[model samples]
Target: MKKLKIGLLINPVAGLGGSVALKGSDGENIQQQAIQLGATPQAEEKALRALQHVVDYKNKVEFYTVSGQMGEHICQKLQFSHSIVHTTSGKTSASDTEHAINEFENIDLDIIVFAGGDGTARNVTKALNKDIPVLGIPAGCKIHSGVYSVTPSAAGKLLQKLLTGEMLSVSYADVMDIDESSFRQGIVKTKRYGELPVPMDLTYIQAVKQGGIEHDELVLADICADILENMEDDTLYLIGSGATTKSLMDELQLDSTLLGIDAVYQENLIGKDLTALQIEELVADYPKTKLIVSPIGGQGHLFGRGNQQLSAKTLAAIGKNNTIVVSTKSKLKALQGRPLIIDVLDQNVAKSYKGLIKITTGYHDSVLYSITD
Candidate 1:
């Protein structure tokens, strides 16, 4: 078989703002602020994790990437032979990502694998316009896009299957994004930017986020009713994002951060749109705490997609047993046999959550779901 040619690109500052609670690293100002806030670049490390899975195929693949932080640094560290097709500055920008995509389009690559979030996905979509197949490594704060693999290692494994012709088809996946300003204000205004041609393997690639699920209101009400009935006095509850969990806050007649983390204590809102530090502080203050989270509609991710405010430290402090997973039965059925995934960026914390966990689906109903790292 002929060697597969792959184009790789990394947005070095993709996920810098996530842990700092900046919401996203979209503009230069946010990037600078995130760095000042002690946020470190994570895209390169995530890209390395994805690449590590494909290391055995080094001799069977031809690699092309940009110079320096864009891609060369990681490729060199992994000792992978790749030609530098483009050069970028120490600090890259959206234009650099677009330029790199354009360069990749001309390389006759079998696939272009990128490491970043929704913004990076949008840039690639705008550049290629669905002319080439691309995959994401999920290294950003906002990953509403469906082009990303379920995990970094999953990306590598999927690419290996694609190269070997095990995965033979592609499907168009939505590239979604929301305004950062509005997002920080606890408002979720997601827009469908475009679509990218992605591999159709559901085991590896995530489906586009499903909207218009308001029809599940009755079920959501039941779930909230259960949570409300179980509320304990003098205990802190960390409410996570998503419409389902927001229903719980709605039932309590409290304001909800639709896409951010909020804290409720003694049936009252204590904090809204909190940062990781703020959450840790709250956890320290209220040792009796429980985290109420709802998984992404089709992805089955209880954390690490949009709610970076709930950092690994916060989850560890909350304890796995203290975490409550809420979802509609239809949502769980959509998984089609995939385990609920956890990507806290801390392997120890993620691995700590093994075996089956309970998910509250209705007022008096629950299901045992397997948790995976």
Candidate 2:
């Protein structure tokens, strides 16, 4: 049987700052700060999950990867047939990613699967010399790009389809990246770096994130009023990141972290820019807590994009029953008919929240919506 040649690249520190509420893990300083705040690197574990789906086809596939944490580690851990195409020492950077891809160009491969966010996608675009198909394992704090699969397991399933010789369409996906410095300050500045050839499958690949703020002031005020009027005494409110949720904090006249999660009690600010662990601890103190979340404008993701502070465990502690889904009518209209996506990287947890859900669109108006994995 002819073996499938696959290229793999892993960014070890891709999402080190997410659970720590650092916004992103782009620079060396930010990564260190995340570590100080108890953020653990999960990119390698996510890569392992993606590779696990293809392990059954070990005899039918060969992998080309870089040494150390970039790719070789996962390949070796899984005992898959693989070749190290490049070597790196210490911590890896965008330069290493570029050089690794340069080496990948020398070998013929079916597809290049990389684990990171939009930054790694930019590096791949910078170094790629051929139009080979590429796919992303969403392991970064920022995933505004369209090249990534919805989740790690989804990426593995896509690879499994390729191994089984399933007919899949190949197309181009935009490689988009945002200015992390500006993102930290609550400003979303996104740019289209380039494009990559990717397999077309909505079930796996995600759409580019929609950036910008809504201009409907009246509707926002109504939503905020409804939330405040219904506020229960002594209950903790976890205000999630996003412009819609920010409006609620603004109505309370409290300090709001534009792009970070905050805690509120009786319309008073309690915690600003909280981490997952911090949120879990705080949830334990409150007898009643509600998590207010809004979906990504274009992608319709409720849990995964730019809100890693709400880890799987945190979501469990909050419980879906105590959750509030807020969105503007226009944002829902933009989805046309697609269901809201929940990609917390835990399939079982994501599945538990699937099905019809209620979304608060205005002060007295809410509609039943569908949630999907």
The 10-residue segment with the lowest total lDDT in model 2 = 343-352
TM-score of each: 0.92, 0.95
Worst 10 residues of 1 by lDDT: 207-216
Per-prediction backbone clash count: 0, 0
Candidate 1 residue lDDT tens string, 193-249: 988888778888887776644567789889998999999997899997878888889
Runs off by more than 4 Å, candidate 2: 346-348
Quantify how close model 2 is to the true structure by its C-alpha RMSD in Å. 1.6
Assess candidate 1 and give its TM-score to the true structure. 0.92
How many angstroms is residue 289 displaced in model 2 relative to the true structure, after the best TM-score fit? 1.2
lDDT of 2 by residue, 1-373 (tens): 8899898999999988889888888888998899998888889999998899998999999999988999999999999999988888777888889998888888888899999988899999999989889999999988988999987888999999999999999989999988888888998899999999999898788878777899899999998888888889878999979999999988889999988999999778889999998899999888888899999887788887779999888787777788899999999998877788887767678877889888999988899999887
Off by over 4 Å in 1: 163-167, 213-215
What lDDT is obtained when candidate 1 is compared to the true structure? 0.85
Give the TM-score comparing model 2 with the true structure, all chains together. 0.95
